[model samples]
Target: MSLTEIRSRIAKACDAAGRDPGEVTLIAVSKMQPDHRVRAVLEEGQRVFGENRVQEAAGKWPGFREDFGAVELHIIGPLQTNKARQAMELAQAIHSLDRPKLATTLARLADEIGTCPDLFIQVNTGEEPQKAGILPSEVDSFVAEVRGLGLPLKGLMCIPPVDETPSLHFALLAKFADRNGLAGLSMGMSGDFEEAIALGATHVRVGSAIFGTRP
Candidate 1:
C-alpha cells in the first residue's frame, strides 16, 4: 500500500472513531525494508518511522538522515541493556522498555548524556511466555521505579496475542495508562489499528500494509 492510502485509512478510522486524525501518530515500521523503499516513504513526506533493531538501524539510517534530516526514528524491538546508549543516540523514542536493568541503564545514560528519548513501558498484556514486555501486574511498580530514576516515561506499549481479540488488550493498555497518568499508548499494527484508534492509541506502528511482506 502507498503512504497516501495508509493515511486515508487512518483518517477514515479516526473519523469513524469520532477522533481528530491529528491525535494519532503513524509510525512506518521500516525494519527489514531496503533503503530505497525507506527513501520512497521519505519522499512521500513520512517523517516518523519504527525500526526493530539497533544494529540494522545503525547500518541504514545515518546516511538516510543525512539526506532527510528531519526523520524521527523509534526503537520498537526488545532492547538489550548494553545497547541502551547506542539506542539513546540513534532513536528519538523507544517502545520496548520492559525491565529494571534496561530502565536503569537508560536512566544512567540519559543523566550522563543529558538526552533521553521518549520511553514506553512494554506490557505483556497477553501474558505470552516468550514476549519481551513486563507482565500487566508489574506496570505500576516499574513505572514508579523508572520515574524515580528520572527516565522519560511517556506511556505504555503492547502487542496483543495474534490469535486473541486485540481490542481487549488495547483496552487494557489504555486503562493502565489512564490509571497511571500516562498519555501515550503505542498499540495496534496494520491489521487492527482502526480498533486501536477507537480505543485511544496515541501511536500505531504499521509495516506490511505499507511496505509489503517482509522476507
Candidate 2:
C-alpha cells in the first residue's frame, strides 16, 4: 500500500472512532528498508518515521534531514543503556523505555544534557519472558519512578503477543494510559492499527503496509 492509502485507513479509523484524524500520528517504520523506499515515502511528505536501532537511524536520518529539511525520528526498538545518549540525539521520541536501569540512565543523561526526547514506557502487556518491557504488575511503580526523574514521559507502549488478538493488548495499554492520564498511547502496527485507533492509540507504527516488504 502507498502512504496515501495507509493514511486514508488511519483517517477512516479515526472517523469510525469519533476522533479527529489529526490526533493520530502515523509513524512510518523504516527499519531494515532500502533507502529508495524511505525516500519515496519522504517525497510523499511523511515527516514522522520510526527506526529500530540507534546506529542505523544515526546513519540514515542525518542525511535525510539535510535533504528533507526536517523529520521526526522515533526510536521504536529496545534500547541498550549505553545507546540512550545517541538515541536521544537522533530521535524526537523513544518508544521503548522498558527498564529501570535504562530509566536511570536516561534520567542522568537528561539531567546532563538538560533535555530529553519524548518517552513512552514500554509495557510487556502479554508478560512474555522474552519481551523487553515492564510487566503488568510493575507499571504503576515504574511510572512514578520515571516521573520522579523529571523525564518527558509522553505515554505508554506495548507489543502484544502475536498469537493473541491485538485489541486485547491495545485495551490493556489504554487502561494503564487512562489511569495515568497519559496523552499518548503508542500501540498498533500495520496489521491492527484500525482497531488500535478505536481503542485510543495516539500513535500507530505502520511499516510494510506503507513501505512494502522489507529486504
Clashes of each: 0, 0
Q: Which candidate number would show the highest lDDT if scored against the true structure?
A: 2
Worst 10 residues of 1 by lDDT: 34-43
In angstroms, give how far residue 147 of model 2 lies from its true place: 0.3
State candidate 2's TM-score: 0.99
Candidate 1, 1-215: lDDT as tens digits: 78899999999999999999999999999999987888999988999999999999999889998998878999999999988899999999999999998988998899899999999999999999999999999999999999899888999999999999999999999999999999999998999999999999999999989888887
Per-candidate TM-scores read 0.98, 0.99
TM-score of 1: 0.98
Put down candidate 2 lDDT per residue, 78-167, tens digits, no spaces: 999989999988889999999899999999998888889999999999999999999999999999999998889999999899999999
lDDT scores for all predictions? 0.94, 0.95
Clashing pairs in 1: none
